[model samples]
Target: YKAFEPQEARRILDKLEIHYTPKHGSWLNMAEIELSILSRQCLDRRIPNQEVLKNEVAAWQDKRNSISKPMEWQFTNQDARVKLKKLYPTIQQ
Candidate 1:
């Protein structure tokens, strides 16, 4: 492979500063997201009875499991800092 250019070097440096989130660290968030999707896909509809709801949920779950879809996480550290600025303490200059 060819050597990295100046801009590539800068990008690498920026990546080095990014906060690495542990895979297990975001399991709760992942579960919530999956539940939200499940709600939108099937639970949001009006079910006739408990039996129908159970079948619908089971069918939807089987359909989901049939395909292997990986989670695509696009949130960056900069996004977290911007969206959750209130949670982080500010430094007095």
Candidate 2:
């Protein structure tokens, strides 16, 4: 797949005929990123026993999920295109 533009990326995906529902809509990208961070922070340490690990993880999960809030998204494709205009190619076709 090639992407000369964002539309080209969509076109190549359509050509492949891969049907997918974007989980969490556009938040899928950020959710994946946050999961990576959570995995590293919460699960990266080695515990001596499963019970201890579970208890510790439960505490961490409760603390995190209780206060966690969804991110505030502001930019759209058009907004990004305007602010980051220099990063994109001028030609679409």
Candidate 3:
């Protein structure tokens, strides 16, 4: 394996910059969620060829676009408390 010389490494490092994202802020999560939905809704079946897969995905995309279902997050903290009450253990103080 070839290793970069010290001067070459310094030169490369000088041209690079690094940035950090804010905590708990990532659009990647939304992308993953959409892909998971796509897998469940459209990719659950086997496709004989690439052409059929492309057509199926395109049709699914068109149908999804036509619906234009707006995402609504009406589930509040209170709703979570009630729905997940069983998941939380009761501790007597």
Candidate 4:
């Protein structure tokens, strides 16, 4: 995957009309975090089959939805500029 050329990937995406995040962007981080939480809370144990897994995940989702609140994201662009400075390229003026 790492060996794949960015230009080739971009060409494919352009052909497919797919939008993408910039390199090193945390666009998928929140969903990844949620999956981690779900794994810890409900999926850590081995389930015998897909049906059991589905039921367990559904129950977990119901319980989570019942108690869920909107997330207040605190990381601003300025915060990202400071914390993830290396991830961004310097602008030429």
Predicted model with the maximum lDDT: 1
Model 1, TM vs. native: 0.59
Evaluate residue 10 in candidate 4 and report its C-alpha lDDT on the 0 to 100 scale: 72
Sort all candidates by lDDT, best to worst: 1, 4, 3, 2
What value of lDDT does candidate 1 attain over all alpha carbons? 0.83
lDDT of 2 at 37: 65
TM-score of each: 0.59, 0.44, 0.48, 0.57
* Tens digit per residue, CA lDDT, model 2, 1-93: 343788888777678865564554375777686678678888897789999988888887788789887666677779889999999879867
Quote the positional error of residue 66 for candidate 3 in Å.
Answer: 1.2
Q: Mind giving the per-residue lDDT tens digits that candidate 4 earns over 1-93?
A: 265699887776677855565354475885677799899999999899999999999999999889886455778899989999999899999
- Model 3, 1-93: lDDT tens digits are 147988898888899998654354355655576689889999998889999999999998898789987544566667877899997677899
Query: Which ten contiguous residues of candidate 2 have the minimum total lDDT?
Result: 18-27
Off by over 4 Å in 4: 1-27, 87-93
Q: After superposition, how far is residue 47 of candidate 3 from its true place, in Å?
A: 0.6
> Ranking under TM-score, best-scoring first?
1, 4, 3, 2
Candidate achieving the largest TM-score: 1
Kindly report the root-mean-square deviation of model 1 from the true structure over all alpha carbons: 14.1
Q: What TM-score does candidate 4 reach?
A: 0.57
The pairs that clash in candidate 2 are none
Could you give me the TM-score of model 2 versus the true structure?
0.44
